[model samples]
Target: MDPRLLELLVCPVTRHPLSYDKAAQELVSPKARLAYPIRDGLPIMLESEARPLDAED
Candidate 1:
């Protein structure tokens, strides 16, 4: 992901900043407890499409 794009991206639900988890290749929103997937270098930030946080994460 581009650094400029990362800076401009936010959680679709809460409009809060996201943390890029490079290891998981995801953008995590702690406030919303959701994980938006990064597929093929594109961020899927839709709340409806986001995955809920699992304890193991």
Candidate 2:
């Protein structure tokens, strides 16, 4: 994802800044522990589409 776009993207639920998880290919909301998928090079920012983070992670 582009840095410019990442700067503008926020958590769809928490409205907090999201961190780019390159290895996971997802945009992670640290505060929310939600990982939104990046599909076909586009981010799917919807809450329903995001996956919950595992406790151990």
Candidate 3:
């Protein structure tokens, strides 16, 4: 993933900063409790596409 693009990207639902989880290939939105998937070098930012985060996550 491009660092420049990561800097500009935010959580679509919360409009909050996203933390990249390289191991999981996801962009985590702590505020929204969602993890947006990153596939084929592209981020799937749609809320419907996001996975709900567990309390332990």
Clashing pairs in 1: none
Angstrom error of the Cα, residue 54, model 1: value is 2.8
**Candidate 2 on 1-57: residue-level lDDT in tens?**
999999999998999999999998999998999999999999999999999999975
lDDT of 1: 0.90
**lDDT (CA) for every model shown?**
0.90, 0.94, 0.95
Writing each residue's lDDT as its tens digit, candidate 3 over 1-57 gives 888899999999889989999999999999999999999999999999999999999
Model 1 residue 23 distance off true place after TM-score fit, in angstroms: 1.3
**Between 1 and 3, whose lDDT is larger?**
3
Put the candidates in lDDT order, highest first.
3, 2, 1
| lDDT by residue (tens digit), candidate 1, 1-57 | 788998999898899999999998999998899999999999998888789998777
Best by TM-score: 3
Runs of candidate 1 exceeding 4 Å displacement: none
What TM-score number comes out for model 1? 0.87
Screening candidate 2 with a backbone cut-off below 3 angstroms (N, C-alpha, C), the clashing residue pairs are none
Candidate 1 shows a clash count of 0
| lDDT, residue 17, candidate 3 | 88
Ranking by TM-score: 3, 2, 1
